[model samples]
Target: MNEENNLEQPQETLGQALKKRREETGMSLEQLAGALKLSVLQLQRLENDEHELLGPATFVKGYIKSYCRELKIDSQAMLELLPEHVEPAKKSKMQSFSRRTEKEANDSRLMLFSYFILAVIIGSSVFWWWQNSNQNIEEPVTTVMPNQLESSDISPDLAVAAPAEETIIQPEADVPTTSNETQSQVAAQPQTEKADPEHSEVVMHFNEDSWVEIHDGNGDRIAFGVKKAGYIMKVTGPQPFNVVLGKHQVVDITFQGETIDTSHFAKNRLAKFTLPLTE
Candidate 1:
């Protein structure tokens, strides 16, 4: 009888037994709570033997049985530690769950706030870059002059004019005005034939029956001639000429007739002439 009573000595406290079982299973308070479908704080309180309220013996027994089963413990032996009430444990678990849920909600709010701040910083940076790029765009430069340009500078006049009054007024009193007077007289003179001493004379040589033509720098024909070997002509003027002999035969020439020698006459042969110009 004494041995039976010693074996049934109302085991250790619920907290002590729970702690021993957790240690044996290598589980933490949180791990045990997860296995028992209880909150961490509630499991902590139960392990600490802080049972202030009591309820039905049957409920407590069931709870103890379930906890022992998860730890692979002897259920009957573990149940000897549980109180006859379980209302306090249930309420404690509810409070612990509520606290954990609140903490999670707070953490989520903080994360969202951090993301919002990051978005604002990135958006501001992009806007600043865009604005700076627009400001950096180069504009074309324009040049300005103090004085406006004249029409004469753009397009010159082609008419000839008499000398200005300033030209007629001589700077040296001793120098004869006869030179200027003579120029005036010459300008007033009528346009009639008076030989100009300064004129060019040219000579032409014909090697065969040829046609000689005179042309200015602009290629306009000034004079032309068709001649046999002994035919010669004299012209008195400043003129450049082109001589054509048969097809694809050509030469450039200039002439101001001073003299000619057409004496030796021949046909289908060659002859030469001389020309001179006064400086």
Candidate 2:
């Protein structure tokens, strides 16, 4: 009965047994800590059975096992004496792996989202560039000055004539009058015209510096230039000439001796119309 009672008594904890075994091997705390690659504070905690201070239940179990290995003691026997509340090392490793996997999954989703945003930005940039390129191709503008005008733009039959000298005729007054009356009579007399009314095909009188381009029925550019103010130009081309004028407010056009009303066709200070303009 006494022997059975003694056998039923409580055994020392895993930490206490490890410490006793280490002392029997004549190894100091520093020497054991160095061999096990553990700090002296950690080794002291383990020897003192400070399970809470040592860290998690899993870490305490690992320290206990390492202590048994260095002391050359049986680890299985000592491990059985651990508290039931302590978790197993396998369970701890599995929990760590699960958390790492969750973190990696979140990172993967973030990366995919970043790629989606980048793709949208690139697509928008390319679309904007494409739209601008098409706009440039569709509407084209040409600028030409009189001095830089090419000979090819003018037809050979369309010769530019110089302005003729004016021959003023003084009307004879039947009776001598005041000087103001004489001046009024001279002002009433008309100045000579630069263009021939009966023979001219197309005539342009510029009130300011203006840009003009004319294409004939056969698509030939008969005359195009930036004409100076008070300048008169005559051009002979096929019927139904295509004309574009920049600053139409500063020009007058007469086709085949009939005045052209360009106010209806003017837009944003420019005019585009066909000669012999249809109603």
Candidate 3:
């Protein structure tokens, strides 16, 4: 019956007792907090008995002892009445959970951004392909049959199109079909000619612009011509032929395809150059 009566009585919490003591000493929260060199929130939490919010048991006990000393209360008495401090394990778990949730949110945002960028790239590629295909489809057809153009009634702009001129294949009569050896064989055919076996002849090869004359020993004119550069002329006559040259340096004479040395007469520009046709 006595214990029940004790339980029924109004019990003062550790915070309420400290608040009463502080007020009796004529100390406000700010004054008490300033004298204790503590924050107003810290003092308020201590007075309100929010020991769990203030952190670990040792720290809360220290703050309470400081408050009691500042308010001139019993520090040991207030500490004995305070509740147990919360466990650090629970706080650690809460922090881990908060970090995990934040990390998950950031990962989700990154995945969504990646998906958005991928979708844009795919959409752009598909749009470009579609546009390119449409351009290919809309392009004009330029090739037509030659017979169709000749038989059908054509537009004036298209009628001016000469299919015969554009598509007609010319006959390859003079066109060389074989290799370059065939061309060399064809070029050698005209320069081949037989000379008389009895009386030997002289051949003059012209390499520049020069007036020349060639006559036999019988005073018969065999050849007389004005030759330009790269002109190959054959003036064949009897032995001891008289060969006149306007420019002696520009002419090259040969007997039986052998070069005749005309360097002895190199000083005289105009002279009768002799030809030893036999040897």
Clashes of each: 6, 0, 0
Worst 10 residues of 2 by lDDT: 161-170
TM-score on alpha carbons, each prediction: 0.26, 0.36, 0.43
**TM-score, structure 2 vs. true:** 0.36
- Give the winner by TM-score: 1 or 2: 2
Candidate 2, residues 1-279, lDDT tens digits: the string is 999999998878767888888888899999999999999999887777767666677787788888888888888888788776454557668889999999999999999999999999999999999999999776533434333323233233222321111111222335446688886775564232214332226788988765677776667676666566788877764567788776677789898778888877544445778877877
Predicted model with the maximum TM-score: 3
The candidate with the higher lDDT, 2 or 3, is 2
Pairs of colliding residues, candidate 3 = none
Instruction: Supply the TM-score for candidate 1.
Output: 0.26
Q: What TM-score should be assigned to candidate 3?
A: 0.43
How far off is residue 114 in model 3, in Å? 3.7
| Candidate achieving the largest lDDT | 2
Residue-wise lDDT of candidate 3 within 133-226, one digit each (tens)? 9997875433232222221233233333222221211112253748998887756653443244224556666676555567666677665544
Per-candidate Cα lDDT values, in order, are 0.50, 0.69, 0.67
For candidate 3, give the lDDT of residue 178: 80
> Model 1, range 151-197, lDDT digits (tens) per residue?
22211111011111111111121334568887676566423212332
RMSD of 2: 16.1
Q: What lDDT score goes with residue 186 in model 1?
A: 59
